[model samples]
Target: MENILEKLGIELNAETRLTGDSKFSFNCHSALSCFNTCCSNLDIVLTPYDILRMKNRLGLTSAEFISEYTEPVIQKESKLPFLKLRLGQEGKCRFVAAEGCTVYGDRPAACRYYPLGFGIYKNEEAGDDFYFLIKEEHCKGFGEQREWTVGEWRKNQGIDEYDDKNRVWMEVILNKKLYSPELEPDEKSLKMFFMASYDLDAFREFVFESRFLDVFDIEEERLEIIRSDDSELMLFAHQWLLFALFKKPTMNLKES
Candidate 1:
């Protein structure tokens, strides 16, 4: 997820590239000398999937959770809106504690892939995704006895599901990157993107409670799923953006 990595100040290069078999030593438990240090004074950008899980885990509505815990950011290249975790006093993540992350199970992809940055290199032809290590001076976990290949590390961190759910949102950002240096999103479009991408509950209301159905021809079955399912709705929201932003025809319009 370039969206997550770009903010971490990691760049993709020969030294950073990882094959599935690439291995590294790391162990970050409460016993580390630098325990919970990385969680503070850092830039951790949250993906939409990250918000979906954290908000649901904390039992907060999308808008409520974001308003309370996220700070808005705009990617320089894409001019797109993004949300970073709002660090609390001492510059620590709101969810971070002496015991380590309070929201560990529902942590962001950036947290899940900690000490390793993941990204995709894309062009007009095709794209290649890769991982890179982020060995910071403060981290003693890397000096531990444990070692893992990139694939093993990913599996151990349970990052596959996050990757799967975040794929579409990643595509949206990457798609915009294709037009960078010249990418300037309109205000209304940015609002729409933010609402659809981050504010799921508001987006749900906009779709079912607004005249959205009157304009777009969504099937009844899919409608039922998105009506109550946040995950499905998030997926639907990205698909709608594909149509709204790029005119990708991901959704059909009702014929008069």
Candidate 2:
């Protein structure tokens, strides 16, 4: 399922967007003719956490993976900059193989959520999320014996792990949308955002090898963790973004 929600309940369309309790039948494997068909000619946006998992899984630096496998794009409506998986010949995904995904264990979030679409609607509180079917013509997974509620399918697909890791990055995007007059991201700011959000190695350099240490009063304990841990560094990067992008004072600068 495609989850834009951080917590429970969501996707769209009264007719197709399903509730957490809504049930559906579907399954996919090499036994079916449409086994790997859904992996091609698609627009898959890479979330920050997706990048982290994938680059490390392939033993590649963020810069190398992005340079070789992805292209930068800006959404027309949201104007939020993100990376898209660059399709190879015939509009096929780079990771698709004769059997299945080469990076199946580290597949991107959108890939894991096929045949299910998810969305969100913000109210005053935590907000409501929903799900829907993405029934492609080539897909025959719908005819299989598997029956599941939206929540069940999400659980079976192991999306909670992805959602948990990506929660903070999603917040940054949502916060961007709430800007008073809207934030038209510039070249420099966009580069900074990408570095913080997806380029962990680059961000590491920025933190330890640049004036970042001089400008921010980071605790040594936290520094020690971020230095060796990519996950911790990614979180620390998100904290820096909140301050740099919105001046939220998340990081206290050294007294000048």
Candidate 3:
């Protein structure tokens, strides 16, 4: 998740590097003076699952949510599209209020994992996945007595589900980072990536309304799932990307 950390202007080092068993003391409550301070001036990049959940929670179409509350960014190094949450006036998060986060239950993974950042470093020999602390000077949550392992904190914050849903999307990103330099995506491919990753409604339309099914041999049961389940559709999008971009055998083509 280097893309995420870089977008947030956060750089991890030896001091912040943590394993699953690593322990830290942190807690956030309305009683704290910094209750909602971290909600502002953030560079929260929304994952595909994040957009999926948030749009569903607000009863907004993916296109509407993207248009109204997100700003699309093309990463400089990877040249891949990234969506950042649009802050309201005064740099406050659009979903944050005086009471706290209005959409707390369906909050973005970044917000849910506050004071902790997840990352994966791609080494030539082996990849390294780990978590790290974001010890911002203004965050008093670290001073709290409630200590927990990174694994426990992830469970408590409901990050496991988000991570699981976003796994394939993250793999796509990692593949892009590793190979995009060698092969630059054209405009049409970029548009497909954007739609598949962020605009689920548009992707749904593309799948059902376009010739997508005509070319690919998707099973009937899988098609049924994709027809009604947004999560399943998102996973199908990742598979489509793998087939389209990497020439992976994720799907079979219709025989002539």
Candidate 4:
């Protein structure tokens, strides 16, 4: 862990010691050393799955959540949309509660991967693999007297579902280096990509209000699948985004 963290030029602290393959156990109890310590000083990136679950958990419309809790910006190098959570006063998360996370069941990938982070850097010469562990200044839970492996920790945290939904987004981010310089995106393409990828409610509105649905030759069955499954919706959403950005030809139909 130290070697990788060093390569990334990040610092290490008591809160973030490497226990690679070490058995560690954690649970919510009154005497826990760093009660709610994990809630402080967080910078979490939200995925589409997280947004859908959290909005449902809070009874929020997707558009409402995007406007209130998110800050969307483009990755300067790739011109890609990225979403980060907006912090409340004192730099704490808006969802932090007196006991623990109010949205514990619907927390973002970053929260689910606490004490561990993930990275995937794929390049022409060499590609990086996925990995996770504790980070600097994260010591609040290390003193726990229980034991479990990294794999078990993830299982207990309920991360597999988020991972499944995030797979396509991960592919887009990791494969950025694969795009040729000759295909640099213009302003319009960049704008569409940013909105389609980050701003969920806005995208939904566009789908409903614009001629977008009419422009795509989507089958009735596929539309039904997307309407029923958020993940399928995301997959189709990306297709439209790609078409918008690259001017790729798509099947044509009538507006619903």
Candidate 1, residues 61-97: lDDT per residue as tens digits?
9999999999999876677889999999989788987
lDDT of 2 by residue, 1-256 (tens): 2343222244344766578899999999899988888888888899888898889999999899889889989856456678989999999998899999999989888887777876654333645776677777898999999999888988888888888888777777667443446557778877888899888999999999999888899999999999989998998898888888878767899997
- Please state the error at residue 79 of candidate 1 in Å: 0.8
All models: lDDT?
Answer: 0.87, 0.82, 0.86, 0.67
Question: Candidate 2's C-alpha lDDT?
Answer: 0.82
Please give each candidate's TM-score. Answer: 0.92, 0.88, 0.93, 0.78
Q: In candidate 4, what are the lDDT values of residues 1-256, reduced to their tens digit?
A: 3455776466655444333354555544546666676776666777877887888788887778888999876655576667788888888888887787889888898888776666555564553344545534546465666677767777878887788777766655555542666556677766676666665666766776787676667788886776656667776676665445444453345554
Which structure among the candidates has the greatest lDDT? 1
True-structure lDDT of candidate 1: 0.87
Query: Runs in model 4 with CA error above 4 Å?
Result: 1-30, 124-128, 177-184, 242-256
Candidate scoring better on lDDT of 1 and 4:
1
The weakest ten consecutive residues by lDDT in model 2 span: 1-10
Native RMSD of candidate 4 (Å): 4.7
Error of 3 at 20 (Å): 0.4
**Across residues 68-160, which tens digit of lDDT does each residue of candidate 3 receive?**
999988877667898999999999998988899899999999988878877775443555787877877788888899999998999999999
User: Whose lDDT is higher: candidate 1's or candidate 3's?
Assistant: 1
Record all residue pairs in model 1 with backbone atoms less than 3 Å apart, i.e. clashing: none
Report the alpha-carbon TM-score of model 2 versus the true structure. 0.88
